[model samples]
Target: MENFKIDVDADGIALITFDVPGRSMNTLTSGVMAEIPQVVERIKTDDAIKGAVLTSGKASGFCAGADLGDMAGGMLAGGSLQEAYDAGWKLNGALRALETCGKPVAAAINGLALGGGLELTLACHYRVVGDSAKIQLGLPEIKVGLFPGGGGTQRLTRLIGVQAAMTAMTAGSSWRPNDAKGAGVVHEVVAAGTEVEAAKAWIKGGGKAVQPWDDKGFKQPGGGPYHPVGIQNFLVGNAMIRKQTYGNYPAATNLMKAVYEGIQVPMDAALRIETRYFIKTLMTPQAQAMIRSLFLSKQELDKGAVRPAGIPQSDPKKVTVIGAGMMGAGIAYVQALAGIETILIDRSQEDADKGKAHVEALLKKRLSRGQLTQEKYDALLASVTATTDYDLIKGSDLVIEAVFENREIKADVTKRAEAQLEGGAVFGSNTSTLPITGLAEASVRPEDFIGIHFFSPVDKMMLVEIILGEKTGEAAIAKSLDYVMKIKKTPIVVNDGRGFYTSRCFGTYVAEGLAMLEEGYAPALIDNLGRATGMPRGPLEMHDDVALDLSVKIAK
Candidate 1:
């Protein structure tokens, strides 16, 4: 039941090891917090312990930080904003206590130190790191629409220079140990598995446990030259934040404000400012919704929440794709890259050759970037077979009809593919708006009919909406899920309907933009509004990229 244990050596140095039970990576939770005070008290009371070194027992990670699931659970249970603030404040208090204790405390970072994990190390007097490439350290709360609720804002500014901390915190950039040491957050970088030993040695050598900010009259390093002039930093930083965040996210601004406000005050007052901002940010509805959607919903979806409860996993190693347009070509390339045997069929040899050439061009680009070796490119290219014959689909485990959106054309391809393939093989339509049930009308076995609606340029987009028609069997859904996962794409399952989810939601964005234009709003203003709303691309820009003709066609 113990999450931590302390052992004191003959030299009066204590090594406090954190090994949370039944977990692969250490995380800060209320349970972990409750135990930490006891360890801190031991170090405080024992006169024999002159210094301490903290390290994790886990090899996978140093710590992943606070459990977002636990936070979401509490929020769903109607926990008040004050309660969350108090919870965070308690952890901050523990970190501060560890910092101010008479004995020195050194942190040995062995792997990822994120959120509360990074905050823990920042509180220590010194830090050493292992040479693992996966050993990254950062406060990434902004990605989920929140700032670091702990003392991350205050400590990071005081440790690294303010400009560096501001960029790191606002961007949520994780750094390697060597980069961290260069930024002054870490003291030394050692070989893998030697971080703890290096930290122990430092503490034993009487390294000062007090942080630079703890010393009176400590001016920040490189103050005059690098500091932004006369609120220029605030203006430029806020503008960039607005551009990137589209004002949909409030965390970035709040974090920037915290670091700016805190850097002007002493450490204690700075921490209070950080806590206030943290509490205020947590109360925002956008933060709550983002945490729920991005964390909890994503977790559930990843665990196959949309799949039928009793359905087992199935891998469709061989797939046949009809047509040689952008969608078909992209799907074929992704499938081949995943090592799946893909049969790409077109109406003519010229079209099939064009599709195969597209795959080769993509592989060549990857090779230029060093993302693919010549050998890998050869192997991936070998996985794809191009043809103009329907008979070539006989061995396909699944056949995706990606031809023109004409219902009769799709129906014809579906009938032909079914006749050529096995009885149990699933038929998927890559149509954006067509109902899977309507498409199933062409199939003799509707249970084998499903919709694998991939967005344009499928290899780049992460979302793949799998539409389950009324007659689609559990095995069909399972196979679709397996295929999407195998190709390293996230699948969102939706009931059979026109434009299922993303497409339907996207229509609203375009409609709003067009409505604004009709109401005498300038195109520039509409574009700005879209950017402010956090759309990756403005509606007008997206309309141009997708072409106005295509939008008209989809609407029809």
Candidate 2:
């Protein structure tokens, strides 16, 4: 009751708003699960209530899914696997009861409805989502080494086709409202403020109380896994899983099993099947480690848990990128995409214009794909000024040097760029190898010098490693984190060192492979083992990706 508020209108529509007090987002905890059955009972018994609508009071999203703290607590409490399995049933049971309570229910999803949140919407007979581009809906539990336990594996497959469902859940893919609707996960996507009314409208329009799979003579979208079409999907899907996961993720394998096995049975039994697989995954050490690193630690870092609280949050209005090569061009494009005025500077107008052309090419591709409006593309392109002028960086709040990775060149650009930066402006070196403290030696304001290492194909890569020099101040770290967030990239803070974090660790993989070759291992065997181990690329392919010549130089 504390987490949920119920109100019944004269039209016999009960609106149950999920608003976890003192929390910015709602999550399915044991307390929330325990409360759901009581609401289900109320909906079923109350003669005046004909149907119900479920929604969130939080502005940020509907729900973030399961409370990780509570989940990890249950799993790590020195309990038996059966105990963990039993605990999962408590949640699975509540969602099941809600679905089959003989009363219609509709979900009014205003924003993100991920993992258990998406599962909750699936349990409803109808779903109405706000037409907000930011709304993220997915069963992303697989990312944390667990599959959906609360009927997600069963219900999603039954709602959408099996192949589509498997792909979405396995990939931890999130979708916008329209995409969710297209996937048959949602019934309607209305204007932003009208989601709640739309849900009420669906229920008032005779929304069914039973799922299609539960109704008499109902058939699954693509028959059961044994059907010819189903066979092809599952066979290829199994091969795909082995190739993609390289059998590294137990959750992915079990999730496919749950969907494959569950769809052949009745709804109730399918839910039980999913819970069994879910608990199997929950008990693995891989799940625990992933939950900590990928979920808990990442969440803490994303919220700026280590940022100095004394320093005000940074909002970088303008940015400057030195050098017009691929890295520098990417930095400028992302800055412009974030609505920041960006200066893309190089040695000549032609070189800088090439960098601008890269941005234009990317914008054109996006426009062709309907990901960007022509007007928006023009504005973003206009925000970036490509030139050779150094004085133009005078107003930049952040100047990131993405020139060649030579110490002398970097030091030279550092002095020239820093001279143009305004008072309080932060300077960053985007070098993957050279130490930030060493780079800071050339800067007049060493306190403002920081390393902001971005990966290749910067627009696609999500991680941005922020290396703090010995002289780097908290304000510099804070501002760099802000700029990384502005570009929608994940930031991991580390001390200044050669190849800071990702690069330092990644280099070892190739080195180890090359070492194996020295030990008389066949080159083909080494590359095959690397790919089969779920690495992004084979050892040789990765070596080629970093460029063989560069790889040899780095190895030395």
Candidate 3:
């Protein structure tokens, strides 16, 4: 009741709004989960209520899915498989009961709906959504090493084709509003405010409560896993999973199993089978670690949990990035995109211009893919002032040097930029090696000196390691964290060290590949085996990605 508010209109349509108290976004917390069944029961028993419309009160999105801070509480951590199964099955039962409650239930999805949120929409007999590209809808639980247990595997496959469902769920893909409707998952797409009206209108216009799977002689799309066409797809799908996951991720394989098996049965029985696989997937230690790191820990870091509370959040009005190569150019691109005036400097006018050119190249790729409007692309491109003028640092609140991994070059850029920089402004060295404390020696404001390490292909990489020099004050740290957050990259604060945090961790991984090479193994074999372990790239390939020159500098 606290998480949901229900109002029955004069036309006998119950509007159920999911609004979790004291939260900016709605999540399936224990209170909200508990109320789902209660609401379904109310819809079933109340004679005056002809149907219901479900929606979220939060503007940021519908539900962000399970509150993993709760570790999904009973669904994964109850000390036994039976306990986890029982807990998950309860919600599945509630969702199933609602769809079969003998009255049409329509979901008025206003914004993002992921994982259980998407599953909730699927359980409804009809779904009407607002037309917004920002509004994403999909089941993305596979990212945190868990598969959907809320009838997602069963229902989505039955609703769409099995092959499409497998691809979406396994990739943890999300889609825009129109894409959802095109995929046959959503019934209607309307203007933003009219989504709720459309949902209510559907039920009033005689929408049926019965699901496709529950209908007599209903057939699943693309047939079951054993059909002639389905058999080839599953055969190919199993091979794809092995290649993609390298047999390391069980959740991906089990999800395929759940869909494969559940697609053949009735809705109720399929829900039970999905729950069983969900429990089996949850029992893995890999899932536990992934949930903690990829979900819980990532959520905390992404929200700036380590940022200094005493200091007010402030993003730099202007940021200067030196070096126009991949890292520097990428940093400037993101900063400019975040609406921060960016100055990209290098040794020459030609070098600085190349940085802006790189931004243009990336923008063009996005434009060709229809990810950016040409006007927006031009505006972003114009925001970066690519030049050789160190004088431009005069008004920059933050100056990041992303040159090579040489101390002298780093020190030179630091001192040159510092001469033009105003008082108390932060200086960030984007070096993976060379301690920040040592680099701070060139700065008049050592307290304002910090390391802002960015990975290669900076636009794609999410992590930004903020290395604290011995004299780096909270203001510099806070400033760096704020800027990182503003740019929408994950930031992790670490004390100064040679090859701090990420580099240190990656060094160990790359070391094994080198060891194999030293043991007379072929470089290609080392890389192939390394990649099979689910690394983004093979060890040698990663070294090349970070640049062989930078790798050598780090080693030295």
- Top-TM-score structure, candidate number: 3
Candidate 3 runs further than 4 Å off? 360-382, 544-550, 553-556
Which candidate number would show the highest lDDT if scored against the true structure?
Answer: 3
Tens-digit per-residue lDDT, 72-168, candidate 3: 6567666777888898788789899889999999999998999889999999999999986568999999999999988899889988888898999
Q: Please, what are the lDDT tens digits per residue for candidate 2 over residues 240-329?
A: 998788888999999989988898899888888888888888878889889989888887777776777788888999999998889999
Alpha-carbon TM-score of each model against the true structure: 0.84, 0.92, 0.94
> Would you list the C-alpha lDDT of every candidate in the order shown?
0.84, 0.88, 0.89
- Provide the clash count, candidate 2: 0
Q: Is candidate 1 or candidate 2 better by lDDT?
A: 2
Better of 1 and 2 by TM-score: 2
Q: What TM-score does prediction 1 earn?
A: 0.84
Where is the poorest 10-residue window by lDDT in model 2? 547-556
Candidate 3 lDDT trough over 10 residues, lowest sum: 69-78
Residues 152-249, model 1: lDDT tens digits: 98888777666677789888898887788888888899998888789989987888978888898787653522465525556677788877887778
User: lDDT of model 1 at residue 51?
Assistant: 89
